[model samples]
Target chain A: MSGSLQTLSDFLQCLIVGLRLGSVYALVALGYTMVYGIIRLINFAHGDFIMVGGYTLFFTIPAMLAVNDKLPIWLAVIVAIAVCALVGVTVELVAYRPVRKKGTNMTALITAIAMSLFLENLAQAIPAIGPNYKIMRRMFSNKAVLNFLNISLDWTTLLTILIGASVMIGLQLFVKKTKLGRAMRAVSEDKQASVLVGINVNRTIIITFAIGSGLAAVAALMYFAQYSTIMTTSGTMLGLKAFVAAVLGGIGIIPGAMLGGLVIGLVESFTTGYISSSLADAFVFLILIIVLIIKPAGILGKNVGEKV
Target chain B: MMNKNTKLKGYLVNTVALAVLLMAFLILNANFKTPFYSVVFIPSLWQISYLIILAASLNLVLGFLGQLSLGHCGFMAIGAYTAALLSLYFERAGIFTDKKAPVFIVSILVSLLAGGLLAAIVGIIVGIPALRLKGDYLAIITLGFGMIICNVINNLPFAGMEGLSKGSAAASLYKTGLGFGNTLKTKYAWVAIVITILCLAAMFMFIRSRFGRAIESIRDDEIAASASGINVSLYKVGTFVYSAFFAGIAGGLFACCNSSLSTASFAFTNGSILNSTFIVVMVVVGGMGSLTGSMLSAVLMFLLNYVIKNVIKASGMPLFVQNLFKYPMLVYAIVLIIVIMFKPKGILGTREFSLVNTIEYIKGKLGKKAVKEGGSK
Candidate 1:
């Protein structure tokens, strides 16, 4: 009886770990799906926005902590969000916008890759952040607040769940209810029709990038909160994983990104916990290839016929 | 207007020129060690042979089949590792004990053939699902495939695979069964040149056949090609597999030439030109769907890389900027971006380089009345 109870607890602990990772992926995957919906771009650099947001937090949090001991985290989170949004807008304007205007499919993909490489290598070139690991000191206290059925829920874990849930719920509500959100949907569904309907396609697209990048900032906070290490190359791997989640949930669908993120997170965590940690990535990709083979459009994506 | 006679002559001229270039490299290799001129451009000739094969094979998939695959290096790595392991097994078995010419040649032939065959099989499996998807999905899946190969290799246990690894991630090819160290170094160029010409000839002949025409039609428009009774899926997979086969051969050649073999040499983890992105850039710069363009761009880009590296070294640039130059991927990334943005069709733009056309170009350049053969770019 004790052995069974211990196994159950271990499983629940694994669940909590999966959920913690799922939330960060969910946030980044949301941004990916949104931008992809609007622009039909993979935006290989979307993951780097998390790093940008992370650097912002690293610089701003310490400064804000000097001002007020307790209120710094929230302030720093807001600043990071704003900075990421601004950076997203700037990247869109400088790199993606010109390519989009030209309307070459190959160029768009190449430019996205170039932008991604540029950010990664540029970050490495900087003297302060030259390819070394920068530590994000622990943010939340690890006090176990609840013990239900012999499963302990710590303060950090609970807050991580709350943060992911609240932010996801808030985003869902905003995208579903607001006028601007409707404009975003309109642009994504039909760019030319949206233009005829008096929707500013470029502005809506830019705003979508901003919102997506801002969400990436939130994901960064969640990442630093849990993993606690940031490096120049970390963003590319994170971005690739998030991109997989976005595709697995159906590329353009909003709720699908969240569901996909959780599935990937669970898959990853279970693989790491049950199988060898080294083989987790291979398993994730294998699963993705299998899913794609079975359902090419993804779980939530609709099968749209091509017009001849 | 020049007739088919002139065109055939032009092709003959091109083939002979390629032979001459190979002979020159062989002569240079036999006499001197690396850094023949001490100008940091020694591998420019040897590197071109494999890169030409890589670029041309990639063109078959990306240029002809109209698939944007970024995981091409994955197939190459499969070939390299497979060839290396096979050679290691042969060495252990003592078939290559005396290092005799005939036995060593047989071993290399078996290993290279096995490597290429293995890569092709994997390509067919990867291509079936990947080719079905359109656009970005295919690209991302290939990207995932490359990473998975890298990770799996990194995790491959040392229990059965002797020589374990040099670095934490790189597998060793120190005592390969192909030949001795000095001899392999000298004759490797000859092996590369022969294999390269054979692969290029096979690819060129295939590209000019009925099958090649059908594949090109698929790239032009999927719906129209299907309407015209082209088995789109069949042709797509066939071309992709064929491309991967040659890519595997290229990888086998790479394993033969290089002293060290690492996962970094075959993936985007390091900012080297060995990855899929670099190959894609070369194909695009050469002109997708143009075999001659692929060849020309491969040689030109290798030279360009040599030039860039030498220029960076010779210049008294800033410390950080010089450090940045250590990664050649940055410049390739920029080059890809600029090429894609400005000249989407690339330098050749679906045209083959003809020797006759070059003669005409030089004649026109010297202010002579040049006989026009075809259209000029």
Candidate 2:
């Protein structure tokens, strides 16, 4: 019984990890869900954009280090986030805008896939950035900062959760109050109708891409902060997980993306801790399949009547 | 039956092209020890052949049948593992000890059948649930299934035996009834290539049948086809099965070529992603529903990769140039984006290379009055 209790404690510790991890997923998922809501095109390159964000941080941090080793962590993170937001906007303008104008669904999907491949290849081709770059190892890579009685937690974990929560809250306010958010919502409802109502669909899409990419930027920073070393392929698995989170929470529903991310994170952590690390993903995917079958509109998603 | 003029032209073209390529290979081979021919030619042959099979099969689903799937690698993994075990087992069993069973030919046939069978089964299961869904919804479900399969395979005990890590030296109970014995493991490259070609041939035949036309109709517009009395669900399942079957065969061929099986290899890693992306690109760049286009694109992609890998290396470029080859997903990602933006329908765009279509054009030019009369009715 004591042994089982110990395992339970370990499982709880993993839950904390899962929650932190889920926060990142939520952030990234927001980008996928938001863009999908408005454009109805799944931005496959969203993950690669996250990779670009991480790489940008990787390079930017070094330049900052050239001036001084003690670059304020918060400042470094902000700069990374800003750069990622710009990259996201650029991706939308360069890769998506043209296809959106044509308005064929297949073109966007294929374009997304192609853009993803292009970004990945471009990253690979860049000097000093290849398959694996062990950006300076830090003492804090795996070190936990705080402990709740017996549950140890890391600074990165806390930051991930905090940033995720704040971003979601920020997005909620932005969507509900801000003019651009209204424009975004209008566009998401119907692009043609919104344009007829005097909205600039192109501008709204750019903003959507900016916000989505900005969230991915936050996600990249947290991801790198937690792991320290980032590989070219890091964005892929995480991106898929975030996509799952978005779907789980009811894709296109802002709050749903957040809820979904946290839930997926907890499930992964608990499963890995209680059963085996190997089964965590299997369990998460199982949940996805079940959720999809039960509620295709997603947990928070509204069911729009099927078009005739 | 061969027309003398066309046959002569064909031979002349093949001869000149081969001669030129051979000269180029030799020259490149001679200088800077180019490593170009050594690296490019052989790998290109193998890679192009594989892509041809993959892209061609995928076209059956995506272009001809208008269905999409992301769990393709799962079928492939199953096919590969099946072939690997079969070949490895037979060799160990002394069935080919005294004289090696033509492992290449026999194993390929076994792998193809096994791949087709396994893929067909999974196709039925997936297609049944997906029948009601359309477009993006179906895409998500298929993507979910792909992820699930990858995770389960990665997490599951390799064939239900615990602690039996891949390539581990320990004796496994599931080893075919063949006693553990010394066996020769040769590079299965030829085996993989031959199987890929054979599968492509079979697929070409299969698609040209009455069934192929039905699939084309379904792809053009499912509702219209169904109203014309086609069973939509049945055709969807059938097309999916055909696609998966080939994907499975490709997977089996991969296992033989790679000589190792790990969940990671087939996971949606950059390598598998590249394979899938290239297949999609090939289908698109070549033209949707055009077998010739798909094959040409497959060859083109292989050549592109070869050029990128070798030209970058031979030029004595920085170390990062080599790393670029190592991370091809980025390249694939970029290509897909570009293709989508510039040429969405791909190269062939539902058109095939038909001499008859060309002849009809020439005949119309020669007899404009006759052509107009035919249309006037």
Interface RMSD per candidate (angstroms): 2.3, 2.7
Candidate achieving the largest lDDT: 1
Q: What is the lDDT of every predicted structure here? A: 0.81, 0.70
What DockQ do you compute for every candidate structure?
Answer: 0.55, 0.44
Determine the TM-score of chain B of model 2. 0.72
Where does candidate 2 chain A have its weakest 10-residue lDDT segment? A133-142
Candidate 1, clashing residue pairs? none
| Tens-digit lDDT track of model 1 for A1-308 | 48988888879978988898888888899999999999999888898899998888888888888888778374688999999999899989988998888736776776787787777777776777777889986777767898787778887778877898999999889988999999999999999999999999889989999999999999888888777888877777788888889998899999999988988888888899889897888888888787887888888988889899
lDDT of 2 by residue, A172-264 (tens): 999999999999999988878998989998888888888898788888887878777777767888888888888888877788888889889
Which one is best on TM-score? 1
**Candidate 1 segments whose C-alpha is farther than 4 A from its true place:** A147-152, B1-7, B32-34, B37-44, B98-102, B158-183, B296-311, B314-332, B363-377
